[model samples]
Target: MEAEDGKLKCNCPSGTFGEDCSLGVCEIENPCLNGGTCVPASNIADTPSCICPPGTFQPVCEQCYYNFTRDAYIQLDSQVMLAINSLNQTQCDEECDKDERCTFNFIGLDGCYIFEKPVIFASGNGDLNKYKERCMQMEECLLLTHILEDNKCFLFNVTLNNALSILRLIEGQHGNNIAEKICC
Candidate 1:
């Protein structure tokens, strides 16, 4: 306690509170969630704040994060796949896993696999023209996918020139449509 204006006032240390600094701020109940750490407020009247971990946010860390189980992966459709001739699933997996630049292996639902660097830029609900205009604004965007059912756009930095080297388009096949960046 320190004397201020002829009256003694209680001053608590870090993380401690109450009349004599005898109680802990986090002693009663912790409010932080999703691996977040609770930090006691400097003033006794103020509430504690939470330090959220990676892939989590908000006051108590209650937010949507990619919470996938171990060994889980998302399967890509044919439109985004790069055709590697004469290579089976095992061979494709081995080749992609060995390549240092190929961090993500996009295994197609039809048993095909892509070796391209899957650097996704943006994804949101929009029409084809809207996605194309948005992609054109970004110099790095090289590919775009617009899902008709959900009206979702997925922009990527994968080059068409690079994709053309390995991909062989199957004529008349239908699913998702991929738009490549065209030069003037």
Candidate 2:
């Protein structure tokens, strides 16, 4: 907190500034929630406001997001993923191990949600939860399924640019190799 011109000011997050910080950064023409920072973008392809802080997940950051497992690996925030946050990190880990469908685990918030398979769009709210869990047996780029999905969930060393091109080739285009190619 800080004071300016004899007025009290709270240390607000990105995209917000005011007395108590109660007012939404984009409350007027735009809006952001769950502590998701708002960034004004001139590009039409981008959104007016959407950051979805660690605890919160969603383009709008309205849901609590957490996920904790093991082996802590690198993950890109921009990629579409299913994430959730929970106050109980242990619960997150337990869920990951107990679920037989789990294909991969991600660490975030306090609890992590495991996927039966490498996954897609999933988010939770940070505003309502706190992260407190950890991962125990996470594998780094252990599975090649991420590459097949083209879901933008691969490690830096696992660039599949050429692989995609090869697999995407139409039948009879790449000859023998094309016939054996697999895609998901």
- On lDDT, the leading prediction is 1
lDDT by residue for model 2 (1-184), tens = 8778987769876544456665443664455675677766555334475776665544555543123222222233323233567635576667667766544565655456555433221234221111111110121221222211122232211223433432232232211111111111
Best candidate, TM-score: 1
Can you write out model 1's per-residue Cα lDDT over 1-184, one digit (the tens) per residue? 8998998878887667677778876665667777788887777557888887765554665544111122211234554445566666687778777766653343343343453445454343456677766666665666665555545455667655554454433333244456776532
Q: What's the lDDT of the predicted structure labeled candidate 1?
A: 0.56
Those runs of model 1 whose alpha carbons end farther than 4 Å from true positions after fitting are 1-117, 164-175
The 0-to-1 C-alpha lDDT of every candidate, in the order given, reads: 0.56, 0.38
- Reference-based lDDT, residue 20, model 1: 75
Model 2: ten consecutive residues of lowest lDDT: 128-137
